[model samples]
Target: MTGAAPATIVFGAVYATVVGLCVGSFLNVVAWRLPRGESIVRPRSRCPHCSASIAARDNVPLLSFVILRGRCRTCGESIAWRYPAVEAGSGVLWLASWLVFGPTFDGLLAAVFCSLMLVLAIIDASHLLLPDPLTWGGIGVGLAGSFAVSWTTPRDALFGAAVGAGGLLLLIGLWYLLRRVRGMGLGDVKMLAAVGAFLGVGGTLLTLFLASLIGALAGLLLMVRGRLGWSSRLPFGVFLAMGAVVSLFFGPRLIAAYASLL
Candidate 1:
């Protein structure tokens, strides 16, 4: 959905960025806990080194990291840089959503879309596992949201889901038939299906194209650096997340530009 510009750029930008950072912080917890079969809500966020509950003051997104000097208060252990990076990245994404979609339902959808993609990207990159809760929950939310959003209809959303998963499944079959080895797992298939539910057919197709292109470039770079072999597996879901983010932001413009040429 294309949303009009926000009424006030300054307020909207600030609001989006702050909320986004907070969301990112929470997602960091989700990414760590969901895969490890831990409750994100039960135990408060703690320093891994000391198991000390992080104070509310110390959990204020990027500032906390800076104020703490990237160290645990209780133990003085170094914090992972990933935390602040995710917050900053998420802030940018949230600001981008506000700029692109304004403060409409469409904007909210964009933010949610970005959040799902970000957390999934982190999880997949770390564990090479896309948990069922996120993928399936995303599908449910996307399809349910289809009726409320202007950009996609329920039928198109369903069709997109089918195409996203079916296309990948077909490719998997072909890869195995030719190589006698799995190039990717079913998790990637399900992840794309979630993408499709939110984006519809054209968006999903474009996402796949962008992801393939980027993934190929990354793999080639890795190979050139002797850091990867053809047999090595890269987390396809991470690339998928990147592709979906691109698709969410610019796929419509790109599609329109291409169609004009056609």
Candidate 2:
């Protein structure tokens, strides 16, 4: 591995941890407010338990979490540990993607995509709802990133985005017609469009298939543990995000293997 050298590994890990910590701070804002139908910008981050304004110094991502011992300074109320975990997790994923794809435009775009997925996973798990702004805004960002990177023709990207969104919408509609219920939400439809815009047709299909597989496994596990009934709703968006990430790293190989199998 190019990252085999001790110095290189150390530098990469440190850089990743720092960036992850900072991004995680912003993610916390998105998590807390998005579901409440509130803008994430107007009100500054405050302690949820005590409502004390957190100082800049005390908001130093992982460092602050550690220094404060995951508690509010004013109320001594313990903060959720997920804060640092998300920040640190995002950083590591971004750094690893950077290393794998190099410093190319695709690498940067992939990092952004992965970060959105991290947010999606966290928010969906917490509330079982994927925010439209994140998914729809991501489509725009992915399209812009594709153009910046010259990864695909503009026509291809546009068509893929349309196909991704339309295809999912159609399926969602059909499911609704037969069952008279909501199946996949609009959030998933928009998210697929964003994924297709970035990954093209083949990758999008692979992502859907992989996501379905993962979702099934997760559902089965939950059912067996008696935590979920057959009718319980699961956040399939998390699995979709997971599938896209996997395909970003190994999509081409999977395509090749499928062709050989055929």
For all predicted structures, in order, the TM-scores are 0.96, 0.88
lDDT of model 2 at position 206: 82
Estimate the overall C-alpha local distance difference test score of candidate 1. 0.92
Best-fitting candidate, measured by lDDT? 1
Best prediction by TM-score:
1
Report the Cα RMSD per candidate.
Answer: 2.0, 2.6
Q: Give the Cα error of residue 46 in candidate 1, in Å.
A: 1.0
Question: Stretches of candidate 1 above 4 Å error?
Answer: 1-7
Count clashing residue pairs in model 1.
0
Worst 10 residues of 2 by lDDT: 148-157
Error of 1 at 11 (Å): 0.7
Alpha carbon lDDT of residue 153, candidate 2?
A: 56
lDDT of each: 0.92, 0.81
